[model samples]
Target: MTSTEAPLRYTAFTSDPEGGNPAGVVLDASGLDDAAMRAIAAGLGYSETAFVTRRDEAARRFRVRYFSPLAEVAFCGHATIALSVALAERLGAGDLLLDTSVGEIPVATGRDGSGAVVATLTSVPAHSRPAGRDELAATLSALRWRAADLDPALPPHVAFGGNDHLVLAAASRERLADLAYDFDALAAVMREHGWTTVNLVWRESPERFHARNPFPVGGVVEDPATGAAAAALGGYLRALGLVVRPTTIAIRQGEDMGRPSDLLLDVSPADDRVRVTGRAVPIAQAGA
Candidate 1:
């Protein structure tokens, strides 16, 4: 293998290569500067890519950076999951400490029921605040959704676990499924509000949910699998007392897009910690 080869690619949150959010993984990015990483990520055209600058084998610690097509992100949950799975395949499944732009993120690796490698990430402290009425109205207009379509149970709020996300729970699954919107308009609103994505979701049941994320800020129209948003959603749900304490909720995402991704979330009321779990797989090169 050449020392200067391009980064490895992998899909996160799904077992199938074509069914998850694809991300570029640079195992050894210590030599690549910010410009180089940005170029590489842009060339790949994925929602986000992860660069591992340093790794501690015995300590299972990694210093990582995430780059979207346009700019560097504070933290990317899917890319972190992919990196953990990749590291687990090589170093054996265990725990990992990640140093990120936002804060230190702790991740663990294990096997799922089907024996697929699953990585569970414990998000940093999460908090949510009510969204401004004017901003909320603007966001709703950009999304082409009326306030009536919103679920009364879940009020509008800007939630943050790692990145800021606008949480708007839909009144029905159909409202969440119909996701066509003004990309530029929504992008402008999100940019103005400093939101990473708009987390549109619907509660199918007390413990199950359907979500779709519009990520125009990241240069992607939509994100099939979004773990960061999920973590934020967990915090929002708990803070609002929408769910029973200490329960695991299943989040179904990317289904409308045909990718079909699943995320398991455990939220505890004792403290503001949300644990999200998903699987990742390496994407085979043209000819391996």
Candidate 2:
């Protein structure tokens, strides 16, 4: 039944298709089962594919799931943003309630300063815990970074917004840019720890940061723009007293990979949920 359906492709966190993380979107996946959904995600071969099972036009509510090329993800930030913008373009900008495996996420879609449709997703909740010495040591060994390379101020933390991400702050931008990891070793540690991605960041200023995410658990070596990781980092910073609440953070990612992406995050004092905003654009069809 799903054989006739072709997923729409979009790249999120950038205004241009060539600059952001690409995603596969199946707007109507009512007839698809888990097997069919997995197959579609495998075929699309993006970091993640989103399937929408239920859509209420009047209420702008949806039931969604995220599947990577290898496995199903609990939550996917870029895909949510992409799907939100896609829905807005068709139904007009407004708010949407997306029900995922993790929890219900409320997203608001609107026009940015550039007039491009952008989506902001409020995460489920944010939490942070100390990164144990053993975990940090193993991760550093896999990443080939010594203790001297870590930022003394930032420390180490395992942060969660929707999914868990290990946050490591590099002492310098140069150290952050040189990312070469033992894939198998890193993957093993990530699997053991149930980590989605390792959020490696370098602070440019109080408000600006540069980040790279190694998503070994998802079968992706790196993620260009990681909204979940960004949110997690925001929470981590707040937990560590690096920043105050009710603040906005700007993260620049994917520059080293040639696909530049921007993620804007808002952390408020009222709640633990973090808001991540970005624009998504449809990719031009190959033969069109």
**Which regions in candidate 2 have their CA more than 4 angstroms from the true location?**
1-3
Which stretches in model 1 have alpha-carbon errors above 4 Å?
1-3
Q: Each candidate's root-mean-square deviation in Å? A: 1.3, 1.4
lDDT of 2 at 197: 95
What TM-score do all the candidates reach, one by one? 0.97, 0.97
**Per-residue alpha-carbon lDDT of model 1 for 1-288, expressed as tens digits?**
122787888898899988988988888888889999999999999999999888788998889999999999999999999988988888898888999988889998988788778899999998899999998999999999999999998899999989999999999998998988999999999999899999999998989999999999899999999989999999998889876668999998999998888899999888797999999998998878
**The 10-residue segment with the lowest total lDDT in model 1:** 1-10
Q: How far in Å is the alpha carbon of 89 misplaced in model 1?
A: 0.4
lDDT of 1 at 168: 95
lDDT of 2 by residue, 1-288 (tens): 143568989999999889989998999998888888899898888899889988788888999999998999989999999999999999899999999999999999999787799899999889899999999999999999999999998989999988999999999999999999999899999999999999999999999999999987788899999988998987887787766658899999999999999999998766688999999999987796
